[model samples]
Structures are given as structure tokens and as C-alpha cells.
Target chain A: MKFNNRNVHLGMNVRLGNNVRIGDNTTIYDNVAIGDNTIIANDCVIGEPSWEYYRHGENYTQPETVIGASALIRSHTILYAGSSFGENFTTGHRVTIRENCRFGRDCQVGTLTNIQGDVTFGDYCKMHSNVLIAEFSTIGNHVFIYPFTVFTNDTHPPSNHYKGPTIGDYSVITVHCIILPAVKIGTHCLVGANSVVNKDLPDFSFAVGSPAKIMRDVRELGGGGLYPWVYNFERGMPWQGIGFDVWSQQQ
Target chain B: MKFNNRNVHLGMNVRLGNNVRIGDNTTIYDNVAIGDNTIIANDCVIGEPSWEYYRHGENYTQPETVIGASALIRSHTILYAGSSFGENFTTGHRVTIRENCRFGRDCQVGTLTNIQGDVTFGDYCKMHSNVLIAEFSTIGNHVFIYPFTVFTNDTHPPSNHYKGPTIGDYSVITVHCIILPAVKIGTHCLVGANSVVNKDLPDFSFAVGSPAKIMRDVRELGGGGLYPWVYNFERGMPWQGIGFDVWSQQQ
Candidate 1:
């Protein structure tokens, strides 16, 4: 949608609408389209690393990345290869969204968060600072993650190996929680602070403690957990609320 | 000796002398001391865990840490239990001196550097930001370590395990170098940036490149390597015609 004075290589598949603004030290490579009212902030590295067919000892691979329109990617946020986001997305400083990841519309990511490749998120998701989302994770809509949470990618980890994790929509992962590799978290769930998740969580549940266990069910306890009461004292409003009416349903 | 309004406990065999100043939020437990003109800054935790002689069980183990005269321990610099420093020391923010270590006088440690336990440094040592000194290492006098250099503690490392590395002093370790553990570096050598030290280097030599090897000798190259060049540029002074006799060692 926008172009810097620096080098840019665009493909024929690229498209853009009006009033899109791009800042300094940003790179948006080929095969990307941006919608209207999108603002890509300063020092952002967007899109995939493109090259001709590679010959690595007679083996090779090919991949691509995409971005939806009206996505407000903030400063120093890196959207690596094979990653995609829906419209009206906003992310804070130093956020890394790795390759093959997808985000729903109006998603918000806080500062210094690291999101690994091949993860998918539903609409209106929110994540806080210093959070790590490992590869192949799935997150549903209306999810909230607090600061300093880490998600792993390898269940059986030999050093430097990566697999992935999974998280469903409408989930609230609290501050300082660590989700171990290959763990799957269900939808409409609440994970307390400083908890370590090592296994699967049931849907519509509330989980807590060091190694997380289900405290109660969300539908039985209430539609939403006690998060609204506890987070009322947090300083400064990050955002008000997201309109979920126009969100597209995933097949 | 120094004592402020913070919580402090002095154990047996602790020592102290004249002209010491301690700041707020400092906790000084057993087996430590203050030398003359030594000013410890705010929010410091000094001294080691004390030995407790129990009615039963094996003998308790605790080591002592000492601070020398005219030493300037700055704010948030933590001297962990079982560490000591000689006279005329200055340290920057959040510098960590781990247990069982010793340092000679006139050593300047830069911000966020970690000096592990059981390490020793000679006099007139200068270290820059984010440098890591491994355990059981020894450094000689007049040594200069640049920013972001890492000295390892184990040659054969198992993920979170710690071993030790050794170094001879009067050496200049450049920025962003990685010194593998258990390797010994000799005295009066110059190590370049981004180099990885794998084996022992001889004294009075220059080493560079990954898996560093000896390139030149500092004695033959003369003029104290590149320090004078950087110092002249930093001080806005000309390189030539400056008499060394007029330059006082004390600032």
C-alpha cells in the first residue's frame, strides 16, 4: 500500500487502496496488498524472503507470506515470511510474528512479544508484553494474553528443536504463565498468572497453579471468568472493546 | 564502615574500617566488610549465605566476601555472596559479581556485565557493557574488555550446566567475542570483535576471526594497540605529540 524511498520489489499480485501510510526503514516485499487506512509504522520488516528456486544439495523449498488490508503494524514489529494478518490489526513495539502465521481482524499485540510461525488466531485477539507464541499454535477470537507469558513449540525438546503449541479462541492467558510445548488450550478459558501449562485444557474452563489444572468451568461459573473484576485495577486502558459483529467465521 | 537504615546483619569474622558509605535498600548479611572511602550505592545485596552449625548433620558451608578501600560500587550492582574486590574499583548499572570471586584495584566494570563466581581479575582492568566473565577464570592487570563479549564457563556444555574458563591479564578482549569455557587465554593479547575463542592463545599476540587464531604480536605492533586511537578520538585530542609523562594515571 505504501512505499519508502528505499529499495522495494513488488510482484504483480500486489495491490493497495488509498490513504495508506508507510514510515521510514520499512520493507514490504512482493505479493502483498494493503487496504485503506493502513499505517505501517517505522523500522518494520514485513513480508517473506523471496528468491529463485534453491538448490541445497538437490533439495529445495518454496514459500510465501501475505498481509490483509488496513493492518496497523507498529514500529519495530517484524512480519517474517509466510505470515498473514486480517484487517484492522494493531501491534506494539518490537513484536515478532514469524512465518506462516495468521491473525484475525482488529487483533492487538503488545510490545516485545514473539509469535512463532504457522500459528493462527481468531478475530479481536489481544496479547501483552514479552509474550512468546511458539510455532503451529492456534488461537481463537477474543483471546487475551498478559505480559511475560511463554509458549513452547517442542514437547520432547532436544536443544534447538521446534514443534509447536495450540490455543483456542476467547482465552485469557494471564501474566508470567508458561505454556509448555505441544500443549493445547481450549476456547473461552482463563489461565492464571505464573502457571505452567503442560497438557490440554477443556473448553469453557478456568485453570490455575504452577502446572495448570482446571479450576472450574466457565459456563457453570459464569459466561466470562472473574477476569473483568481482577483486571479493573490495571493502569491505563489498553483499548476499550472490539466490535465482533463484522468478523468473518473460519471454516 | 558503612551502615544505613536498611536491614543488615553482620556475621562472625566480618571486617570493616574507615570512611565507608552505604545507601538505601541495601541488605548486607553475614561475612562481609567495608574498607576506607568505599561507597556502596543503592539497592545492593552483599555477603554470602552464612554457615549454620547444627546440632546434627554435616558441617555447614559458607564463604566470605570483602570490599576494599576507595572502591565505588554503583547502584544496583549486586555482589553475590562469597565474592570480594580490591581497592579503587568502579562499576556501572546492574553489574553482577557472582560468588567466590576476587578482583584487584582500579577495575572499572561497565553496565550489565556478569562476573561469575570463583573468577579473579588483576589491577587496572576495564570492562565494557554486557561482558560475561566465566567462573574460575583469572585476568591480569591493565586488561580491557569491550562490550558484548561472552566468556563461557564450560567447554562441554549440557544445556544449563556451568563449568569454568581461564584468562591471563593485560589482554584486550574486543566487542561481541565468545570465549568458550575451559579455554585459557594468555596475557597481553588483543582479541578482535565477533571472534570465537576455542583454544589457548599465547601472550602478547593478536587473535581474530571465528575460532580465533594468533595473527600478530602486540609487542611488535606497539602504541598499546588501538586504545590510544579510540581515546584520542573520544577526548577530541590529536594523536601525536602528546607527552605520556604529563598524563596522570588518576582521573
Candidate 2:
């Protein structure tokens, strides 16, 4: 009850790599393969039972869930079955990820962020707190999203159809922005805070306002316009101190 | 363990009313008083210990927590010590309320919302999903806040100075909006979606856009505007079918 390290309830065929640390009241379901040096905190549910299991109960089979090397999953997080992540995936408190999601290396999902099922995320994506990505969102690499951003899939209310927004690589969606259904944002675009994006934005666009209008090229912006954060702002970024020029060359 | 009814871990001097049903793995801390017919679902923490308890451990005394009759708190919610709620309070999953917050009757909080400490709310307040209210927020009666809206108390980040926004009666703040510190929104105001409100808005104003502009009087808007939501849109409101005029006359 002290929130100390407790032996969690693990199902069959669960393979955990070396030096994995799991905290109190954490439950890992069957067929979950967690890589080396990963730390999962208290009250987490990895490979949580999916929708079918709820209806079928004990007859359901939980699908595979994989978390790659050096991942740090924080407290009160819930990752549903059939999701997979690459190396160094991280999450803050109370995050929720549904089934059939894929993530690349070095992704950081912030507190209270909810990713609905069937989403794909590329490497080094940072989704800060309270970000909600509805079903079928496809995110490219090095994308940064600020708090209270919503990627809505259903354009019409109470409809079965969903068309989640897609963001290309190295783009930054600022705080309190809403990306409407089926909107595709090109690479290296900067979406300013409190903007409502209703249409497709071309590459390198600096967009703002409700029903966002592109003002200019993102490269013309003062502090942002990302490619390794546009070689301008790199505080706490993955490739910090080691220059983007050198980093891109290596990649 | 199944998420069935279970006796939670309770501290000394705890009290519960008749027919109060509790679900699995909920832990209620010291001096908590839960009123009659209240149903708390699984994995909740009622009367969670305060910051001093975390800092000082056993020496810290938890303040008295109270929840009035017919409150329904869902799974994975955490209500910190010294908070109080009036009758018919409800919550969706994974909500967190910090210390010293007060809520009046018929307040409904949606999923993944986090209310920081020292906030006060009047009757019939509804906060939809993923809303974050920072410290010292004051909300009046019949306030409706939509998803992904944020109430920020700090004008400058990482600074000591804090001033949470105050909202008057029957105000509806729409989705993906950010209310900046020290801003006051007057009664019957309608805040449009994806807006960044930095200035004080007068009564009955329909505000929209970044650095939100007052479009017109809220009563002029087609579907929305308060005083029973302007008697236009009243879907699922408390005074539904009974009629607001009849309800208000009775009150």
C-alpha cells in the first residue's frame, strides 16, 4: 500500500527483458514482450483487455503487446492489447493507449494524453499533456504537440465514419489547437496556439487562426519551424547540443 | 481481482452513510465522510493524503473530506484531502482533484480532467473531458466547459505569481480554449471553440478567436446563450422537460 515495488500479476508467455522494473499494483497481461531496462510505475495496465474481451469475457484471447528497450511507463497508465512500441518509448501519468497502435523509437507521451486505437507514430514524437488523438491518426517523425491539442476523426456527430488527421514529419502543433477530420499537415509546418485547422496545409506553412490561414513559410518564423526544431529551439530535444546539421548527417 | 464490490482500506474516524456502494480497490483515507446512496466505482482514492502527508509521512494529519449524498465517482479518480462536494456530484473516469476544492450540488466532471487545489465552484457546473483547471479558479453556477479547455493560473511559466480565471454564472466555454491567468468571464458569455482568451470579457458577450474578440451579445447567437442555455439548447440539462421557467420558479 506504500506504492513500493510489488510483484505484478503477469499472464502466460510474457517475456520481459533484463533489468525491467515494475512498480506497485501494475498488471501485465499475456504475450507482452517488454525490452531491457524498462521501468513501469504503479497502477499501470499493460495489455489491457480489449473491447471483445469485455463482451465475450473469459473466452477472449488477448493479443500481443510489445514495449521496446529502455521504456519508462509512468503511474496510472493503461496500454491496451495489440499495441507495440519501439526503443526508449516513454509516457507520463494517466496516459491511455488503445489497441493496434504502433510507435517508433524515442517517443514521449505526456500526462492525460489518450491515443485511440489504430494510430501510427514515427520516431521521436513528443505529445505533451492533455493531447487526444482519435482513431486512425498517423503521425510522422519528430512531431511535437503541445497541451490541449485535439485530433478529431469524426467530422460529423455520432457518425460511424472516422477520418483522423495526419501530420507529416518535423511539424509542431501548438497548444489548444484542433485538427479537424482528414486534414493532412505537410512536413515542417508550425501550427500556432489556439488555431483550428480545417483543411490540408502544405509543407513548411506557418498557420494560425480559426479555420487556420497560412501566413507565410514556417522557415520565416522567429523561434520555430522545425527540422531538428529548425536549428533554432533545441532545449531538451533529443538531438540537443549535438548539432542538427551533424545529427541529420548521421541519420 | 474482479472489479466488484469490495471493502476499501479506510483510515481512522472514517464515516459512510447507508446504502453506499463501493467498488474494487478503492482506498479512502482518514476522516472522510461519504453521504447516503453514493456509489464509488473501482480504483478510486477518496480523501487521498495531502502534500504534507507525502513530505512528512506518518506525522502528517489528513484534513477532513466530505462528499454529500448521491455522488457517483467513476474508476481511477483521485480526490485529495480537504476537498468537499455537495449533493448529486458526478465524475467520469480518471479525474483528479487536488486539495481544498469546493463544489456545489449537481456538478459533473468528465474524464481525464484535473482540477488543481484551492478552486471553488457553484451549482450545476459541468466540465467535459480533458479539462485542466489550475489553482485558485472560481466558477459560478451553471457553467459548462467543453473538452481540451485549459484554465491557466500562471501568466508566466515557472514563476511564483498565480491568478486563476474567474467565470460568472451560466457561461459556456467551448472546446480547445485557453483561459489565461487573472481573466474574468462575465455571466451568460459564450466562448467559441479554439479560442485563446487573454482579456476580460463582459456579460452576455459572444467571444471568439485568438486574443478573443467580442463578436456580439450572446443572446443573439442562434443555438447557444445561457439563462437555461438561452432556452434554445437544453439537451440533457438538469432542467430538461421540466422547463427552466418552472424549475427556476420552484427554486
Candidate 3:
């Protein structure tokens, strides 16, 4: 059930699994592998050349892009070479996933989000619209990011060394927040809207405001609970229908 | 005269004015009206079903999307049903205008900007790339918003009532500013970059910082001046015939 529309270009050694739908004018370049039940929407440029330029106009040879099963990639997305995604990866329109990135299972990225090169995301991470995760960032499992958030990687532009932020498991970053370069947010932390995180935040903290200060512990906050999706995955991936009852109960 | 491609899907009762160009794989749904000299780029999804779903499985039946004359909707834009745009409307690539949104004449929305449902914009509003205007917001005439600005519509999530911010005429909101819900920014105000706007700002004020405070009047600022495009519009939409003079002068 592979439907390759007109003007779709598949490069050398590209492997697409069963029930894969490739839309018109979409280009999946060399060494890419897309798993079963994946839909790559129209005008997407998957496995494009990496944006890694070395000294004196030299470019790094990008590795292949590997996409797992049940992925829904919306229109106009540009997934550069050397990126990998696990099962159940969903993205809204015009997402840009750059080179050398790894996304774990059940990751949902919203519209216009740009994950720069060399980023890593653990399972069940959700990023809302218009977010930017800079290069070399590491996000743990069950992380939720709201709209218009930015994670900086370089303190100064054109620096030789760039170190992005690190977020532990179950961290929540609210709308319009900016995490500066090399910042670390520990597990189960909640960063409030319009905040700027410049330092390290401890586990189970509720941080708010510009230059985000730890307000209180997560236990002190009402309506704070573990992500329902994680609970479903614990039972066995509910998206795959193994734990539908557990997922529905949470909903 | 409508020029439909092999893969273009024009719905029933859709009206296209003279000299309209729609690119390949574009879908214009039922009751959409496009005026003369409009260009809709490739892979666009025009008049798509709105994301206005209510509890108990009820959904809002969106009205027709209407576009005025001399518009340029770039590639991969998703203009939902019930949105109305005035003359000379220009949008960058992959823009998303939700249902029931009203954009005035000469409005320019940049790439990846999302205008949520029920938003209203006055004439000549220019929003830069990656902006998010939440639902129910009102922007007055000659408003210029820089990149990555977020307008919050609700103080708390899942609240029954939501109220967005009000931006007055000739105001300029710089990059990475977040305007809180129900806040009012007065006419001709200038909000600086990376600021969090939590309170009402007076007319002609220049505000900055977290919980943005008014530093001085905009007139006192060195670079304070009307947007160059306004000068061209005053000269009777010179962009149509002035041979890029108005456009290049600004650059």
C-alpha cells in the first residue's frame, strides 16, 4: 500500500515500509528508512543535506534519517539528514527537524517548531507551536513545552563550542519562556509562562518569572499529576491499543 | 478566470475572481471567495475545517473564507474556514489563520504566524515571523509585531471565560514579548524586546523589562518613527506601482 504521488523523488537505498503514503513533490533522500503506516504530506523535504559547515566551506557528510512506525508528518515539514524518530511521531505543519537529532516514541511536535541540529528528545515529549529548541539540547521523557518557547545553545553567536539546555523527565515549560545556554531543569519542574530560565532548577520545583525563581515544590501545587500518557505507556503503549482502557480512563 | 491545476481541488460554489493563480495540490473548500489578482502558492490548504470543537462532540460549523483583491498567500498556508481578509493581504510561508479571524487591509503576516480564532486586526498590521495571537485578541491600526511574540488569551487553562489583550493603534511590540490576557497597550506605545507585558501601558510610552515598565515616551527614543510602509500606503498603495521604491527604502 505504498502510494508514491507524481513528482515524488526517492533517493538511493531509501526504504519505505508497508502502507506508506508519500505526497506529491516530496523528496526523501539517500539512505532514509520510513517505517509502516507513515504519511509524509505534500511538499515535504525529508533527508535534506545537513546545515553543518566546517572550516573553509567543507560540509559534514550527513547520516541517514530513520523514521519509525505510525508517523504523521504534516505538509511542508523539512527533516534534515541524520535525524531519527521512534514510533508514533507526529508533527504539525512546517516543522523543521535538523540534523543529528533523535526523538523517542510518542513525541508530538506542534506547528512551526524548529528543533536545531544535535538535539535529543526522550519518550512522550510534546512541544507546542512556534517553539525553538537549539542545537545540543537534551530533553527527557514526558516533557511538555508550550508555545513560543526558545532554548538557547550558544551564549555568544558563532562560538566554537555550543552547549544547549538540559531538561529532566516530566518537566513542563510554559508559553513564551526562554532557557539560556547550558541551563539545566531537573525532573518534575514547572516553569511558568513568560519566564527566562538562566540557572539550574532543582527537582519537583515550581519556577516562575523572568530569570525564573523557584517558587515552591510541585507537591504544594494543586492539580499537579504525572502525565496520563506515561501511565498508559506503562501499562503498554495505548496508542497501539494495548492499554486503551488505561488511556481512556485518564481522558 | 480560474487556473486550476491537475491536482487542485476547488470545492462547489467557490468563487475565484479574474487573474487568480492557484498552485498545484492546493485545496480550496466550499464557499470560499478569492478576489482578483490573488496568488495562492503550492500545497496550500485553504478553507480547511476549523479546530473549533466543543465538549460532547459538538463542532462549530464554520462559515466561508473570504479574501479581498491583490492578495498573496504564500506556500503551505492553512487558512481555516470563516476567516476574512481585506485588500492587499500578504502572508509569508506556512501561515495559519484560524476560523472567524478578521484581518484588515494591507495586513502582512510573516512565516509560521498563527492567528487563533475570533481575532480581529485593524488596517496595516504587520506581524513578523513566528508570532502567536491567541483567541479573541483585538489589534488596532498600524500595529507592528516582531518575531516570537505571544498574546495569551487565558490566565488559567480550562476556564470557561477567556479574554485576550487589546493593542492600540500605531503600537510596536518588539521580539519575544508576551502580553498577558486582558491587558491593554495604549496607542503609539513601544514595547522592547524580551519583555513580559503584565500591565496596561500608556499612550506613546516606551516600555521594557519583565513585567514591562514604561521607561519614557516613544518620542524621546532615538529610533522612533512611523513604519515606512505606512508612508507608502498614504501615498495610495504605492507598492502596486511605485517599482519597489517603498519596499527598498525600508530595507
By TM-score, the best candidate is: 3
Candidate fnat values, all: 0.00, 0.20, 0.24
Candidate 3 residues A1-251, lDDT tens each?
01336678988889999978896668888789999988787668999885453332444554789999988887678998889999989887789999899999999898889999999999888887888999999999878888988999888887877999999987888898889999999987888788889999999878898778998886666554432223323322343454546554785
At residue A100, candidate 1 shows an lDDT of 78
DockQ leaderboard ranking: 3, 2, 1
Task: State the C-alpha lDDT per candidate.
Answer: 0.66, 0.84, 0.81
Clashing pairs for model 2 are A227-A230
lDDT (10s digit) by residue, model 1, range A120-139: 88877778555688777777
Model 1 TM: 0.45
- Model 2 has a DockQ score of 0.14
CAPRI band for model 1: incorrect
Best by lDDT: 2
Q: Give the alpha carbon lDDT tens digit for every residue of B1-251 in model 1.
A: 33564533344565667867777655455567779988878755566232131111135455677888998888656676677788888899767676778788778899867676678887778898767676677787667898767665633211134556566755788987767767777876788876777788887768896657787776545555453223332221122255333332422
Better of 2 and 3 by TM-score: 3
DockQ, per model, reads 0.02, 0.14, 0.20
DockQ class, candidate 2: incorrect
Poorest lDDT segment (10 consecutive residues) of candidate 2 chain A: A221-230
